[model samples]
Target: ILAKFKSKGSLNLHLWTNCDRKSMSPTTFKSQLYTHTGERPFACILCDRKFIQANLLTVHLRMHKMEKLYLCSTCGMSFYSSGALWVPSCNHTGEWPHLCKFCGKKYITSGKLAGYLRCHTGERPYSRLCCDKSFHTKSALNIHMRTHTGEKPFKCKCHKAFSERSNMKVHLRSHDKS
Candidate 1:
């Protein structure tokens, strides 16, 4: 069945055939074990994404719903998941598995690894250029850009233009005030 699919040039499609077992290789069985154990050996530092296996991380994403099990006593910081706390703690303790190529910076979480890359690139976007002026952060830049672009992706029933959807909602109340 796998041969048939390969012959048809459908390698990208994950088709579960009724004729035979779904797994094509022994590697897949190993991945199944990792998935069951939630043992994500592969991690991303740029984003809060991880997978039990490297192959899974290619498609799998960070589950935002995971419980925040760890807490910081010093800073009173809380995370949405245990992985978030785990990585940061590991980084602070010099337990990082991956090292950055550009800089000597090391990170336990792939998300933080990517963020560190931004520091090397110097594109952290502390300020954004719009209409020959700079504004702090992309949100502010987006709002300022609207003034020059005259594009309102967000709209209210009152037919007023807004730089952001949240601003549009706030502006809508003004119509009722009058």
Candidate 2:
């Protein structure tokens, strides 16, 4: 059937189906035809972005509208989607389900409990390739790497730069005195 479609001078059809000749439904064929014919019926009014499906356009419009429909009754926090509000709202009673076996400390998430376990086990998983120094967290090792690379990301109005934001704030104070 794909060979028949290809032989019928349907090169665009071959590209859309990715050479999959079998199991081509009428609805799938119609959608692929719309793609090749540049027929995007659903469009975002906020932006010029066009989508083939109405549901996709609806989801995209939420970003422009900034709709916070999902709300938490306890914390007074809002979320754009119901799924975003579900987890936090379920844990609203401030119950830490994940507990550390070593220290018996409770954590809201598994990732936080794993980080705490690393402290007791002396597990410094993140290591610097430049030096033999290791850190429990990737963020701590990243800050350490800036010292060796001398990469000053924080810059002042006077064209001077510092590796840390705290050091940059202190340098800005010197400018105020002058």
Candidate 3:
């Protein structure tokens, strides 16, 4: 796509596939490096940050000057630049494209899928065992082994593990309940 644009003698917008949207242009890329490194040839007395581009330096100076030009319509919150509004989140409603080959469950990220694969192979090694039964995952099998060993490694200074801390806390509370 970029090759086609270059061939047509239209060099205004280069289709930079790998660069960030604002950083696609060569001028912007160089300027961004200068901005990030605080090497502003045009320095503002109000703020210490420097920018290679005078216009960008002016905007940067406004920040130190506490000048807010971009305002949010929703809550009237102000921002120094329009660029401050963008935030990526895991709020997409699209179906997960990666399907687990073993269990057919879909996952949004590769890490979750990798963890799910361990369930199929039962490959996680145990540092401890419950009674004679072996299990995967140290945290899981440790909690189970505690019942037999009667050991509580997780403890508070008050000699109590909160309900969120360990299952032993819940089990200990159960004893009081009975």
Q: TM-score winner between 2 and 3, please give it.
A: 2
Q: Model 1 off-target regions past 4 Å?
A: 1-130, 175-178
Superposed by TM-score, candidate 2 places the C-alpha of residue 45 at a distance from the truth, in angstroms, of 26
Per-residue CA lDDT of model 3 for 60-136, tens digit only, reads 76665679898766556777777653211121345575679987998766666776777899787544422466555
Over the stretch 31-146, how does candidate 1's per-residue lDDT look in tens digits?
A: 65553444667876534344556644543333223444458664556665454565556645668776898967766766667666765776645343434565334455656766
Residue 170 lDDT in candidate 1: 82
lDDT of 2 by residue, 111-167 (tens): 778878888999998885679999887667767878997777666768897877789
My TM-score estimates for the predictions, one after another, are 0.27, 0.41, 0.32
Per-residue error for 173 in candidate 2, Å, reads 13
Q: Please list the C-alpha lDDT of all candidates, in the order they appear.
A: 0.56, 0.70, 0.57
Clashes of each: 8, 0, 2
Q: In model 1, where is the ten-residue run with the lowest total lDDT?
A: 1-10
Cα TM-score of candidate 2: 0.41
- Pitting candidate 1 against candidate 2, the one with the higher lDDT is 2
lDDT of 1: 0.56
Candidate 3 residues lying further than 4 Å off, grouped into runs, are 1-26, 29-39, 86-178
